[model samples]
Target chain A: MNITKVLDAKGLACPMPIVKTKKAINEIESGQILEIHATDKGAKNDLTAWANSGGHELIKHEEENDVFKFWIKKG
Target chain B: MTDKKKTTIVLFSGDYDKAMAAYIIANGAAAYDHEVTIFHTFWGLNALRKDENIPVEKGFMEKMFAKMMPRGADKMGLSNMNFAGFGPKMIKDVMKKHNAIPLPQLIEMAQEQDVKLVACTMTMDLLGLKQEELIDNIEYAGVAAYLADAEDGNVNLFI
Candidate 1:
């Protein structure tokens, strides 16, 4: 899948990761995909809930080397 | 009417940590496109206060209160482990080390996100807090206004 933008939120705590993700998603047009890399454990659930609540779709997410990566399609 | 989800929080504590929690949730909800409101009442009004002295005229009791309460969110004490006001300092230092967003910036972010920040009029009167002493661009209202926003709210919390 083609990625429109990438947000590096590694080492950030709760709310910042999601906060940065929201801001990043708004920069792209609807249907575009946003890639986010974060280290906060809570970002998994938080980003999922955030994407759902904002009408966006968390198409895929994966954890590698203690970094969580998420691909979200903006709605 | 728009079908936006709503989150309303009644900020009733003067503690720094509690206020931080309230703002974190508020900002997160706002980021999720939820209409958010934080109603500042009782000691919670301190979070909205201006840091500098405003030099407002007041009665004796009001003056006493003004002197006793922390001037703003930055000066607020913690609800737990507040060892003679040293806990806030420790927590702030730790937060800085962790790259955590501080309380003042969180409040600013909320305002920028258009989160409706309302100061309870009744509590403001009781605390002798004048609008001039609070930050700009915030609404002033009582419990009825809070209820109006909270009645249909998807998440309603009293913090």
Candidate 2:
């Protein structure tokens, strides 16, 4: 079973959150899930674009308490 | 498989607008899955500084003119373009308000995306800049370094 890891990127700006998330996802095996929490409005688009471009799958994304959440699966 | 494309941007303009334009292009390229690098030399280094505290113009005339124009980095006033008098200042103010990435953050992102950053040793030597003067995490290299990266890619832009 693959573990779901959480990445908190709140209060972080563009590129930081994305950069960290990319690093985290890189360490995960295929089908493993990494959840990213961020505040930048650009992250939704940025992460989605990154995932698609890099062959990762975006499983879920949401916003709560002004934080944007994304669940991405490593390819 | 389609060959992954990359780009190299040589930033020579010290004007705020030009720097901002380079950032926009860099960001776009990154979003599109292209590896991007930005080389700051001469005046271009000012835009990357973290201590920049220039104010965002709020006066009526400045506001009016800003609204009627491209505003910010998009309006850099290169000499050939005279009507673009307020380009530099406008770019600075917009960058300030938008919290545009500081040089440090920009370097961090470029590294994260595997974008190579090369500080022009020739220019640095000419400007009397020491390695300590630059932000941490930047690779100090000469034109040969930039050429190495540029040669491997198809996109080469001199901003």
Candidate 3:
């Protein structure tokens, strides 16, 4: 999948990662994909809820070496 | 009619942690494209005060209240484990270490996101707080305005 922007939110705590993701998602065009890398465990659930509420699609997500990565397509 | 979701928060506490929680939720809701409003009342008004003292004429009681209350969000104490005002410093340290955005910046972020910051006019009068004592770019209103926004709100909270 094509990624329009990459957001590095590692090391940030609750709300920061989500805040940054929201801002990052706005910068990209609708229907484009935004990739986010975060270390916060809460980001997984929070990002999923955020994407769902914002009408975005979380197309893919995976955890590797304690890092959580997500690809969300703006809706 | 617009279909945008709305989140209205009534901030009634003066504690640092409580204010931070309110702002965090406000900023987060705003990020989710929800129309957000934080109504500052009573002790919560301290979060909107200016750090520097402004030379505004006031009565004796007003002056006393002003002297006792915190001047700004940064000066407010924590709701728990305050330890005679040392808790805020410890929390600040932890927040810095975790790279979390501080309360002031969170407030600024809310402003940037166009979240409506409203100061309760009735509370201001009761507390002897003048408009000059608070920060700029915030709306002044009573409970009526708050209800108008909250009646159609998707989420309403009192913190």
Candidate 4:
């Protein structure tokens, strides 16, 4: 899938990745996929809850080495 | 779904880590479209104090109180391992190394997200903190106001 924006929240701690992702997702158009690159270990669960609560769809997520990547489609 | 989701926190600790935790939760709740309210009382009010000495008229006791208390997040001490105010710096350095947003920035983000920042009126009086001493963009209310906000809140936390 073609991603509209790639938000780098790597090297950040708990809540920072989600916070930055939330801000970055708003800069894109609806239906666009926002890819998040985060290093925080808890981003996996935090982003899941964040995407769900914000009414956004978590299209897919995967871990590449030490980094966790997520693609969210804004609702 | 029709009613607004509420997240209320009663912040009573002046510790840096505790304040950070409160801001983290507030920012997260606000991000998810929740109406967040942070009722800062007692030592927690220290997190909102201005660093600079504002020109405000006060009596001797008030002036003494103002000077005695730590002003702002940068000046606050940790709850443990203080070692005469060195612990905060160590933790702050760790936070910086991990590329985390500091407490002050978190507070700014919370405010920008429309989280209700409130100061306890009774605490301000007890601490001798004047209205002019706190940061901008905050509400001053007593316990009743906090109770009203927390009564129906989905997440009510005390830290």
Candidate 5:
């Protein structure tokens, strides 16, 4: 069974959220989802580029009241 | 994907001229198609500040000392480094004379090349600086944050 993990990356900046999300994703099997909660505005762009470069799937990315949520489905 | 190598540079040199070597190297790496991330820390963090002054060598002896020194900025480590203490102002002047582009322009070029410039948050707090005090349009992060991005196949180095 695939597992999903929610990584609270809020308050983390730039590369941190991306790095932590990647680590969390690595702990799971392929096809699992790693949900990253980040606050840095740069993540909106940086994460997308990172996911693309790493060959992972970014399933969803949304912002709610200054909080950013990114869902990555591990490859 | 072609599996191009990724690299992360940790800059801790605060001396103006010394820090330039890292900035130059980071941009050079990206220019060659390598993905680059620079985590500015400690004295190195000043290089990212918008209002930070480019230090100058004072007095005749200080100037003579600078002229005789190897570029300390490049000494931050790793190979392919050397500098004469003329410092960042002199370095900038020399580059400008050669039409080598300005630091701000270089920064823009780095961004255009997708180089990641990460300002260290802890250093910022210790210095009592605000995010607005840094160069416009760069990102900020803690050590854990930088390590995360650097964890996957990126050549990590302390510059």
Candidate 6:
């Protein structure tokens, strides 16, 4: 995926990652991808629900070395 | 969402942890494009207070009431394991370590996100709190107002 920007939400807890991700997503144009690297375990569920509720597209996501990476396309 | 949704939270607890949870939920709902309203009543009104009391003339009983209660989110106590009032501090430190925004910041974020913050006028009068003592930018209304808001809300929570 071609990400327009990357947000480092690592070490942040629930809501903060989502908060930051939401803010970062606004800076990109429609269809542009925003990549978020977060460590909060709850980020996965939160981001999934957030993307769905806001009509954003979760292009891809993966987990490695205890960090969760999410690629969200602005809708 | 295909249609707009609303989340209404009745904040009735003064506990720090409970207030945090309420704000977290409110912020999350707002982030997801949900219209959110937080009705602060009774102890929950403490979350809206200023950190320092604004000097105001009042009767002795009212003064005592104002002085005894927690001033703001930072001064609020934990519901349990207070440990002589140290539990809140410990939890705050832990929250800092985890990089979680505190209740005050969450409240600010809630405001920035346009979450409706309505103070219960009845409770405010009962608690002897003045409008000037709370943080800026909030609505003051009675139960009927909150009910009006909650009536059409898709999510209603009591915390």
> Can you list each candidate's DockQ?
0.82, 0.15, 0.78, 0.69, 0.02, 0.80
In what order do the candidates fall by DockQ, top score first?
Answer: 1, 6, 3, 4, 2, 5
Clashing pairs in 6: none
Docking quality level of the chain pair in candidate 3 = medium
Q: What is the interface RMSD of candidate 1, in Å?
A: 1.1
Residues B1-159 of candidate 2 have per-residue lDDT tens digits of 347777889988865445545765676566556777778776555434334223453566534533443222333354333354754455445556755564334545555666656677777555444455455566777777777768876678998
For model 5, how does the per-residue alpha-carbon lDDT over B77-125 read when each residue is reduced to its tens digit?
2222224333444556666564444545555656766788898988766
Which parts of model 5 are misplaced by more than 4 Å? A1-75, B1-4, B52-89
Q: What share of the true interface contacts does each candidate keep?
A: 0.85, 0.11, 0.78, 0.70, 0.00, 0.81
Candidate 4 chain B weakest ten by summed lDDT:
B25-34
lDDT of 6 at B37: 98
Q: Which segments of model 3 are wrong by more than 4 Å?
A: none
Interface RMSD of each: 1.1, 3.8, 1.2, 1.5, 11.8, 1.1
- List candidate 1 segments past 4 Å from native: none
lDDT per model vs. reference: 0.94, 0.66, 0.94, 0.90, 0.65, 0.91
Candidate 3 residue pairs in backbone clash = none
Clashes (backbone N, CA, C under 3 Å), per candidate, total 0, 3, 0, 0, 7, 0
Better of 1 and 5 by TM-score: 1
Worst 10 residues of 5 chain B by lDDT: B70-79
**Candidate 1 lDDT, A1-75, residue by residue in tens:** 999999999999978898889889889999999999999988999999888878899999999999999999999
Which wins on lDDT, candidate 2 or candidate 4? 4
Model 3: lDDT of residue B17 = 95
C-alpha RMSD by candidate, in order:
1.0, 9.9, 1.0, 1.7, 14.8, 1.8
User: Residue A38 error for model 1, in Å?
Assistant: 0.7
User: Model 6 fnat?
Assistant: 0.81
